[model samples]
Target: MTVAERKDISNYLNRPYNIIIKSISDESGDYYVARVLEFNGCVATGETREEAYQAIYEVLEGFIEDMLEDGEAIPEPISDDEYSGNLRVRMPKSLHRDLSQAAKLEGVSLNQYLINKLSK
Candidate 1:
């Protein structure tokens, strides 16, 4: 992936509601077949890996909404091994646009650019 694509992927991955999806495949003599092996219970699987990943997000969103409607406590965010801290912030639209543009110029997504800058 290009740096920009990596950045976008990183941003989405950092979201509290998103989970890192891992899959494994069995290697046949001529071809390999893979399936999603592990995911947070929030996501559901499909016949294909791509479909499973796509469907899981919707499932997760619905699950969360249902929990809220039932008055259950919301779950905490999951962290990746790369990052040690978690913080949430809100920015104005103008600033967000500016930052997003800057990040794109640097071949990164907003979240990744910010994280890379902040980590220095």
Candidate 2:
């Protein structure tokens, strides 16, 4: 889509909906997934990036219509950093134990070892 078209759509959606788009890869790196996150109470996904974005817009429109019918209040749009914070991911017990052992062998804490590895 052209930049102008995207801006137009964004303006239309700014008042009533919150949308986020993400590009992700499968574990095998053979396929791409486009994920739409936190669209009020609904989430949508598609194989292609553009398809995912379009699906979210269509779904949001329907959701808004239903809310209007039910006389429910629409939520305000969220700011870019509204949900930003420290994030943590879980590791398997075996992997965690291995990492801890490696860190001990290196004479460093697990967090420091991981940080150093990641930084490199």
CA lDDT of each prediction against the hidden true structure: 0.60, 0.66
Cα displacement (Å) at residue 40, model 1: 6.3
Residue-by-residue lDDT tens digits, candidate 2, 7-103: 6445645664445666767775532333224344555666776777777667776665666567776566666767765558698999999999999
lDDT by residue (1-120, candidate 1, tens digit) is 467745644554446654445554545322212222223456465556666677776665555556555776655554477486777889999998999999999998888999998999
Q: Poorest 10 consecutive residues of model 2 by lDDT?
A: 30-39
TM-scores, in order shown? Answer: 0.36, 0.44
